[model samples]
Target: MNKHFYQKCIASALALIMFFSLFAGANPAKAEAALNINADGAILVDGETGKVLYEKNADSVLGIASMTKMMTEYILLDAVKKGKVKWDQEYTPSDLVYKISQNRDLSNVPLRADGKYNVRELYDAMAIYSANAATIAIAEIIGGSETNFVKMMNEKAGKLGLKDFKFVNSSGLNNRDYKGEQPQGTGAEDENVMSARAVAKLAFHLINDFPDVLKTASTPKKTFREGTEDRIEMINWNWMLPELDYGYQGMDGLKTGTTDFAGYCFTGTAGRDGKRFITVVQNAKDSSGKGGYKARFDETRKMMDYAFSNYSKEKIVPKHYQVKGQKTIPVIKGKENEVKIYTKSAINMIVHNGDEKNYQPVLVLDKKKINKDGKLTAPIKKGEKVGYVTVKPKNGEKVSFLTGEDQIQVDVIAAQDVEKANWFVLMMRGVGNFFGDVWHGIASTVKGWFK
Candidate 1:
């Protein structure tokens, strides 16, 4: 048997296997089953891609408590970033804000009526310390009133496309004991409610849009006016930071929330080797009252460990990916012999570890549209979408790299322009191609006779 013939037979067999594999379904290598977390609602997502890695009751609506402050910070920080508010500008806390800060039932930074705090100081206290009074004070400064600020928070939620969330107060605290100027359209019964997924989304936006929030949230401790007669020291409650467990590397800043109604909630973020993840755990019970804080942190750590251990960011089709099999398509009348082609945009997917090799990128050319007899008629424009490169798993649809549901199909496009060929050139090429085909047919017939 001829070596070429043997190779061809093997190639054909492989193609058939692939064709059936598409319909037969893939058995992607499985990771260890996701760990069961002790939380009423939870989610873990890739920070860069917004890919959900783990979720349990993530969409269940419940009181979000101080997680509400993530929104308030988003709104207020956006205002500050937009020059609508100034960091150095001082604002006197209202009687209501002073009262809330002083309330023993809630977490606060102890703001006094006589103490003049700047916008930056107030924001730090609210973000790092979860100060209800400071949050409300910032709201009044930015939104002109607490009620209007609540409206702004809801509006921002709507803009973010949050499905299961509502904000009734700037702070996540319950409103029963609070007697201040309520926003005009608000009532005491209203409280901030959202799902774990919604809170994750909010965290995503906060870190994505305003990375500076991470800087403030990650600091374990900071003194606003150090060595001063009126200095105030603030400490971050997020224990995932390096100061606590330096081995829990890349653990950075994010907010922690807890209340009688919301339980213990945390929106945690961490990065390692350029990969970052955002995790949310809401309504985690303190099985033992002493371990309440540790419960939520442990749950977050479990999810993050699962994610970092099992998953990685992979490029589905790279930005500079050149079409492998066919770089150029033959042209009938174009001055150039062929026009180069490529995909329009880069595609990325979060693939489980060790499954990268299973992804197979198959090029499906538009034969009917582009070429009937191995020649495409020109004038071909640059960047014209021509075909598709489908990235499928070797086993099938069941184990596809993209979220394990859909195969990633990327558009194949023309890379450059091809001008029309002149009449003489077209006639000459036509004659050459005709004779070439006849010679090839005769050669094939001769080979077949020997076989």
Candidate 2:
């Protein structure tokens, strides 16, 4: 064929290939429903990445019942860490604590108005038994009074970026006088309200910040105020604990909630093979036509089982993983003209079963950060972010197959320190590079002329 004809044919073939490549890679896969949980609101999140695996009415705010104590726990634990309260720090309960303790209608750890209990005892009562009076006493100690404590709780909720959440009391117990920041009366109507998403976020924050809470919460049963006359037995209400009938392996301690208005609710967490999951269910009902806590545990088990059975932790980008095929980045005024780079931390992802083999992540580097000359300023500090690697679906259709469409951006940083170049080193390198560039240019020109 003539040269012109040959070139035209090649162009036509390349155009056809390009068209098919774009068409095949542009379609996004639709995410299918994995689990159908029975609840008014629910959420499941990957513990390590905070990725939402499943959610239904997760943003609808309603009364959270005793689960509000999770916030109480977060605040109390934070106080301890900040030296605001000691494990042995004692607090004097007011008449209100005694009233709540004696009110049989509510859950309480018997409190003596004149008696002083340490922070640790109160925390145990609240975490294990969901004692309303103990929660109040601790809140009072933390914020000087119940009203002030509620304010602190709300403040914390705000800091956690929780939306559609309101704290009327430190304890989740209903107060008739409080409603969404407005107190009407002293009846059993006022209660702290939050959405499943907000609760899940709070739970994530709790475990991420104060992991010690799990130690107390995981205990199926323990004695509060041990070795003292005031000591009382505390039983964990979370039936998902391994010792319970509905228990499963790896299931640890979390919080549970129950009330006429809130029905049965639970925030559960479990770990296996270094992968952890957190699930929250609200207003769940039982299969036996009962409207009690059974449904909460039953539904929680289903969600937990589905997650544990289907998902796994995969290290997509391992720490110190060299960027394959990446040209060495040129360093300006450094001891060397170029430097090698590697990932600072591993990029792990929670993927469903079968997906570990199918889902492939593409590393997208910032074009601006990579210049044509591949040059970078020297004095690079180790772990200092230099660019970003966006982890996206290798196949566009896989976008829908994943939990979220948004790409995970990992900061690509310098793996090691690159010291500034001395003046003598710079001068020597510059002369060497200039000659190298000239030699390469002449060699390339001569080679092209021959071709």
Candidate 3:
């Protein structure tokens, strides 16, 4: 294949691999399979539980188009959460904002350079319409300047544990100098990219950390009729909504993005029977780029359906649980004779019912472990981490890492250092100690009563 063909082929192949890895899970025969896609990277995870249900190159960093808007939402909502801004706060657009909003990379908010909008309208334009101008307006309102706001965005991402992505601009529009010299969102400075997993994670924070934002994002089929400039047509780019697909009625608001470097991308959420899930699709094809959102909607539905149909978040093993280890070891002075280590996640693997028996929990003990056995000795302290019990769905499941328990400080010590004497000696000592103890006891009793 030519270099162009090679790149295209790799992109295609990577998309497929990531798609299967994400959605398919460990079981192949389970009928609850999701839709397939050509996105270079993808991931689907339970939003409420943080369980990764399906993931494509979910970890592979790729350009995410307007999905950057979600970060904008995060920053603004974070401000709202901290009382830095509010739903009704009004902000005026500066000339720099107006000048930048006019760029083709932005959605026309119809606001003049000096036009003022409340936080509500700015949020609406930005969330519902993915308005670039609205983003600048919101950024300025929150950060006192676009540069300052973008700085805050990067900081928040860091605090949230988003390592692969960064922001150099508020709108994520690639800035190019007069010579067209700077690359599009690919400059040495333009480092705004994220993996599907991280994007879904950020969405998790957005929906969970600030549900009000989701309330705004989920406004499917909003009618933008501002001052009647022909009520310029603006429809949600996400198809996984009631207005677009009845089956996807349970789906809620999220953000979408696309850039040639990142391809078509979306970070979305949906629910069914109280079980909600988040999804990320990167380099998912609009293949034609005419906005490949339809493919995203279709693929998202498949993954969500698969999750609800096959998995039910069952708690298989209750706590106070121990997955017997491969070997038991001695501790120095622990209250318990031996410590049991297990996996931290749970004995509950996302397995199909048919193969449930095939999986076995393993007692995984590490040779390096050496804690005093609780039964030996201690000023028993409760809740001190001892060791953990872990379970694996399959025996050879890479010997899933160990999980340890806090040393449950039992009240009694197993053995005291005081020694026991022979019968005769014990008798003599007992008689002597008895006489002394009795004399002392009587004396103490008399003294206490007198006092």
In the range 1-451, model 3's lDDT, one tens digit per residue, is 5899999999999999999654444543222233455578877766764556566666688887678888889888878879989988877777666665566545555666656578887788789778777787888888887678777887888888776786766765554411232222335446368777678878888888888777777776565545765245566667666776433757777887766666667788877666777878887655454446576666666677776676664445544444444333443333443433323334444443344454444343332343343221233233334344433445342311111121111111112222233467657766988999999999999999978
lDDT of 1 at 396: 56
Sort every candidate by lDDT, greatest first: 1, 2, 3
Candidate 2 per-residue lDDT over residues 325-409, each given as its tens digit: 7524677876666666666677777776545444443444556655666677787777766665545554434332112344454
| Tens-digit lDDT track of model 1 for 282-315 | 8775545432788888888888888788787777
**lDDT of all predictions, in order shown?**
0.79, 0.76, 0.63
Query: Against the hidden true structure, what lDDT does model 2 obtain?
Result: 0.76
TM-score of model 1 vs. true structure:
0.74
- What is the Å distance of residue 289 in model 3 from its true position? 11
What TM-score would every model get versus the actual structure?
A: 0.74, 0.79, 0.66
Model 3 reaches what TM-score against the true structure? 0.66
lDDT of 3: 0.63
**Which candidate do you rate higher for lDDT, 2 or 3?**
2
